[model samples]
Target: MRTPASQRALLVKISENVCYTELVYQRVNKKLSVDWSHSETEAWVQAILRDPDSLVEQRGKNYYVANQRRKSQLTVNSHNYRLITVNRLSK
Candidate 1:
């Protein structure tokens, strides 16, 4: 089993990007007052990255449960999320 510290680090690393398909978006936002846009999703996942303890559930690679209702069932592939450390330079 992974240590608590190691697991926290892994959560931070994987939360770099929270990937989801259109179907996920539609289903998730169907009852919500606001639409779950990409930017919103990114921000929500980033918040979780900042605080892994906030996660209500971590069920393998397919799902994560955050405190926020809209972000609970998000499909985040930590391995697939690209790590962009630097800001883009303007041409």
Candidate 2:
């Protein structure tokens, strides 16, 4: 019989390996790079992360969120920095 799509090794591996955990008593950890991928998934991933909004395609198997910033007139005058936000959700 064919393997159930949800039970596939690739997807299961991604979930087990990609997610991070922290102790409830301690502050959360921060990461600059979300180091998870396969050659097949890379192009699809780029299509999303490269967007101006910093959003990715988020296929049914996985989700990715991102942050982006552009210089603003007020920020330029005030010498402030641009801001960005990134988030993700997956089933």
Candidate 3:
């Protein structure tokens, strides 16, 4: 499990590859019924990256997941983030 602080840092490192459009942001908040901050969104993105198979499916360049898991705990799906690239940032 990743701490929120680490997740925030990771999000900053991958900010270039992440795309959360206006529509996507709105939809995510609507779905989750919470006004999520950028940190929250980043955390969700990290969770999704950790488990790509959990995604519902790829709709074009976007990946959708109805829910996410932290370890074995389930969480509500907030939004889909398009990963523009998959470079090895770390080993």
Candidate 4:
């Protein structure tokens, strides 16, 4: 079982991205919008949505999520979203 604070941390870590928070809020306002602050690093995520398909195991570290772009779509308009794609860049 996860404590309230721990759960909050996990949610914050996952949704550090703003657009993502807004997306969730739009869908359901139950619990997940209390700590979606605006981060500059995460801002780029919204501006440029990048989703990698693979994880880079370098020095025993999953570099995929580490270097992931935290972004999400807030627009409910289906016409605006043609397709969302993420490219994996590993070397």
lDDT of 4 by residue, 2-40 (tens): 554554443344344323344443333323233434353
Prediction-by-prediction clash tally? 0, 2, 0, 0
lDDT of 1 by residue, 4-88 (tens): 6866766666664545566655554563444768677467556756664544234554434344433333345445643222111
Report clash pairs, candidate 3: none
List model 2 lDDT by residue over 3-54, tens digit each.
4443243233332333222221121112223343333233333333343443
Q: Candidate 1: list runs displaced more than 4 Å.
A: 31-33, 55-91
Candidate 1 lDDT at 71 equals 37
Q: On a 0 to 100 scale, what is the lDDT of residue 68 in model 2?
A: 41
Best by lDDT: 1
Model 2: residues >4 Å from true position, as ranges?
A: 1-37, 55-87
Model 3 C-alpha lDDT per residue in residues 10-86, reported as the tens digit of each score: 44443335565566556556655668886686676566555533323334444333223332222222243353322
The top-ranked prediction according to TM-score is 1
| Shift in Å, residue 36, candidate 1 | 3.0
Cα-based TM-score, every candidate: 0.51, 0.21, 0.41, 0.21
- Candidate 3 segments exceeding 4 Å error: 1-16, 52-56, 59-62, 66-91
Ten residues in a row with the worst lDDT in model 2? 72-81
What shift in Å separates residue 26 of candidate 4 from its native position after superposition?
16
